[model samples]
Target: MSPGGKSAKSSSPSPPANYSAAGEEFIGVDDFNEDAHTPESKTGSAYLEIHSRQNNAILKKNQEESIETINYLEIQSFELLNT
Candidate 1:
């Protein structure tokens, strides 16, 4: 028995050394043909795309608003200094 009552033979493998050099194997036609026309899958993908676009637009708008606020503050500061 090893530490914590676990045997040495039950140890997991270490991370691959040359990970970048490995190539992924694609599944064959039989696996690919499965779920060729899934309505739920199509709907989910469309929803994801729309949600992603909306979130991106909201983020851009917030960034633009922040820049405008910063510019307004700078202009006010300049005006105050000139007075």
Candidate 2:
């Protein structure tokens, strides 16, 4: 109830067209418009940049893990030789 004695309308927040809440995008089947080009290009570039960063991070973590494994294996080899 509002102060003016009117019922307030309820609305759910929604993502804009072509985008999902999980950060995925969908391409429309309609014909493309010139005005839509710039925004779409920018959105695609931004999405690519984000994905590239995520991939780089994963690669870095994997490299670190590999280095740790190699160091552990080297230590084990040295211990085995001493025994």
Candidate 3:
């Protein structure tokens, strides 16, 4: 170390400073597409085909269960004298 102590060197580049204002048109929310944010699945066709079949089966099972539950509720509601 030198008797007069100072940092040897700096190697970082300085960033440029700039700011500007510009005018542009603004549109209402009605113009926006709802699907813009949801990215489409990129899975290949074969994988999607297998997944679709599995999902269809699961959906049918769930739908059947839902209808059964609804039927039970409807019967229970019919038995209730007080609203």
State which candidate has the highest TM-score.
2
TM-score of 2: 0.53
Cα lDDT tens digits for candidate 2, 1-83:
98899998768666555555554665641322323432346556566678789999999999999999999999999999999
Candidate 1 segments whose C-alpha is farther than 4 A from its true place: 1-40
Q: Which clashing pairs does model 3 show?
A: none
lDDT of 1: 0.60
List, in order, the clash count of every candidate structure.
Answer: 0, 0, 0
Candidate 2 local Cα displacement, residue 78, angstroms: 0.7
lDDT of 3: 0.52
Deviating ranges (above 4 Å) for candidate 2: 1-40
lDDT of 2: 0.68
Clashing pairs in model 1, backbone N/Cα/C closer than 3 A = none
The total number of steric clashes, by the backbone 3 Å criterion, in model 1 comes to: 0
lDDT at residue 70 of model 2 (Cα atoms): 100
lDDT of each: 0.60, 0.68, 0.52
lDDT of 3 by residue, 22-76 (tens): 2232233223233331112233334456778999999999999999999999889
* lDDT preference between candidates 1 and 2, better one: 2
Q: Considering TM-score, where higher is better, how would the candidates rank from best to worst? A: 2, 1, 3
Worst 10 residues of 3 by lDDT: 15-24
Per-candidate Cα RMSD to the true structure, in Å, reads 13.9, 10.7, 17.1
